[model samples]
Target: MKIEQQYFENLLEEGSEEFELIFRSLFKEKYENLYSLLDDTDAFNEPMICAAFSTPIHIPVEQMVLGFLEPLPSKIDVVSNKHGVVHIPKLGYFYTNEPCESLEIRIKDNNSFAIFKSDKEVELISFKEEVYINDTDIEICRSEDESIIQFFPDQTENIQLESGLEKSVMHLNNAYHLIKKHTPFYAEWLNYTMRRIVLFTSPQLNSFASICTLNNAYINLNNERVSDIFFLEEITHQCGHALFYPMSIDRDKLFIMDYTTPMSHFSGIETDDRDLINAFYSFFPQYTGNYIFDVILDHEENLDEDSRLELIGRYAFRMYKYGLGIYQYQEYSDQILSEYGKEMFAIFREGYEKLYEKRKELFDSLDIKDQVYVFDLEKFKSKNLQKTI
Candidate 1:
């Protein structure tokens, strides 16, 4: 089945409904008859409830479930995870010492909240980090201590390093504006599914990397300076993963076999078929982004020669990488993908193949020789452009 715009609309509706069902079931399992005692069940719509459902924390599930208790306690001690932070829905996070479990929270007659720890009772401090980029609201935060880490081909140390939020925010704003202008579909997709942009750093993570933290409403990004094109590639890629993740919760209807069964090592590491399909889905949309750069080159009058080549180099470089993924994965896609999976894969494949053929001459003109090149403009020009002798 060819994927139309309606497919995304359907997918969003289906996935959201399924996640809510899963949450209700789990809530019932946790609270049992107490679940029926709730006065307002609509508290389930709180984002942190969904975040806790998707995230694996060291604390008991009751810790999260209790946050939804209709009449919150006058003075209750909420347990912190190993991260030294307590996450409450609607209420923000509270910090404490590590290895500490209890934070005494008191709700005053005025309904103001306070934290009593270390023999001191003070007003609770909550930092809700949020910003508006391209008129879209997004929270800027870091991955929780207990959240699942991103998959990497090589084993590397992952720790949150110093990130310059000012610069990163500027770059993201520019990138989102460009995405809104050129790849409006992806922009809308991101606005729908993405809620948070988590930041971290690893020295071995190279310049930059990003991954969707399973079903959590966030994606992790390496803290580094990167081009606008890099942001375009990553923002679209991880948001696609985040958008499609919830549907996998309904595994029985979506797959014929165990959805987690190891199926391929397209990234030089064993990955399940479900993940592989997501990766392919992630790559397909970037070609539209690649074409946008082509349009800018042909029509934009303000671009100097150096700026023009930089865009061209980015176009050629990404096309090669995206093309290679389709070539390698297309062979094995049918072996494991379900009918639904195959239909989606076909759309990705057909969409990319059309663009590849349409840009055949430009693709042939690129003399890129390295397989592991980043957006190295100087190297690309040296290899692809003739020198004036």
Candidate 2:
């Protein structure tokens, strides 16, 4: 894992004269260690390394490299020098460093550039600007007023940022505070797993928030359709998806294999199919809702009964959404028990029923209008369970 500091220093001191030899040796060693750490050896190819480093989450790459390298006198600023060449000021430079005729810079931005190199020619491959918030790099296109249009760098053409995007970011930060104060586990999980939240403008296509496991990020639409509680719900919900990544790594797949049919749920009049992993993941948002309710109830002595009721109702609605999913997937509980055992199933079923009961009690206590507003059970009913994929 250790990178030779003296060698890099010598490379920098000698500049282009020693660039080819130093870069080939240094980059090969550094990338091998990084690939080993990530459990991904294929990414060490020249094209893959170029692509990975150009993306926003390349901090993980920086982490792997810097983790073993000797500390420099000051932070090395990243800069591009020539075609297919990037200079890490005071550290060293990386380049093809060969005779070339046709050179192309595909894209050039302030922070990074992409280039293509061969023995005959070096060319600019592409370029992108990365925005960093709180030292975490984000892929976003900014407006004149500094408003953000966030999207995954790879899918910029398919997605666009919505109007009032700034407001959504504000709400996201507010939800982060609520999570940090109320759900310490989610807060901690997010610190390690969750990478970024990409915002989309089209409501018809992205009415509900979603998480993608491959990127370790959330993709949410800027639809002003729900309360702040909903934002917190999505945050915790997506964090749950992120949590499953590490949790599933060494686990047995028997339960999922046995229960391969998708579970149905309703967002409005439309029905959607959720896979076995997602059906199980529903437990997380329900757990998050219960945790938020507990935190509020812990301060019940200082609040009026009306305030308490409203808070409980809001969180209960969130819990009910996930509880309903669990209810729909209950038939597969035995399969889960068979694979994971009785104790695990018991713990899951307990939380599942507890949320259902709590939602029932909260709904019954409300007046007819409040009940109508809070308990939308119409969304939970599945017309058919026999449909298989």
Candidate 3:
């Protein structure tokens, strides 16, 4: 468990033979189990090797591991001026006692890059969330050791109060996902901007909400407080833009794609990485990276950027009361709409209230005092009136 930092740093620093050894060993488990060498091919291109072994690898293997100095059976092990000492566990992978001075890795599925630090544990940092709100100040102190990752808030950001990040890592299926659906979030109420609502229907886990980063979008679904009270909070947070986004941005913004709706939602694909921006009214909703906004009824979008984000937040709040999850009530004849006078809101409304009540009963039983944003229809209506019409 304890490793010498200087040892691994040498691999890349000096291009030492040991560096190659370490990489080959560590990656053996990956190539042996996860890869297939189809033809009589002994070695692949460096990129191909790195792709199979450890992806988002700084120097994509491009022939580092299987570049046959000996037969494919005999592996290489050496010490480099840069990489201290390495031992290849398998032909294409290596393990070392030290951390590489500098390494870059990306999730093969998402291609999100992380700068590997030369610490005892493998560490990666994310500045997008931090820099988006404040540049000079550190935004997130997220760190990880091996598969388990943690989220932390920076001290110097000038943001008052502290957030104790919850840590949970699961090597479930493809990758590790650590979710935070718990709070005070510092006792901060679940407004549209920060709401966790999830509706998971996996064979393994039937969950209401969770927070995780996937290939497409950063997603967070909260139910840790009310535990299924507002099942749509997270979903609506992302989908609200589908209703409130303005088509045009008055000022240039970096992250806000497509006035209110993402390019994916308009395009109709549930999740796509390359093409982002729903320029054409296709209404394909982005289902990844903070995807929770529910947009089936309200169609008018924001032409200006300011109006778009504001409306997004507003509509997200609306989802606390109305989301597709609740509207699935069998009693409603025309589920999407309830007509001018007669309200089917009561149908979904009644069901959600029951769900909320059930959650409250559970919370009371558990003695948890977290505050959940209860959907008060009257108050929600009043809040909507203040928005710029």
Best by the TM-score measure:
1
Clashes of each: 0, 8, 65
Q: Which candidate has the top score in lDDT?
A: 1
RMSD of 2: 14.3
What lDDT would each prediction earn against the true structure?
A: 0.56, 0.41, 0.26
TM-score of each: 0.71, 0.52, 0.22
Q: On a 0 to 100 scale, what is the lDDT of residue 301 in model 1?
A: 66
The sequence of per-residue lDDT tens digits that candidate 1 reaches over residues 221-322 is: 443236555555556555555666653445455445554544454335554454644454445445445555555555666555765666677677777877
For model 3, the stretches where C-alpha displacement exceeds 4 angstroms are 1-216, 219-232, 235-276, 279-282, 286-389
TM-score, structure 1 vs. true = 0.71
Between prediction 1 and prediction 2, the one with superior lDDT is: 1
TM-score of structure candidate 3: 0.22
Candidate 3 lDDT by residue in tens digits, 212-320: 2110111232223222212233332332232112211111231233333433443345664323222211121211111222221133342244333333433344333
Q: Order of candidates by TM-score, top first?
A: 1, 2, 3
TM-score-better candidate, 1 vs 3 = 1
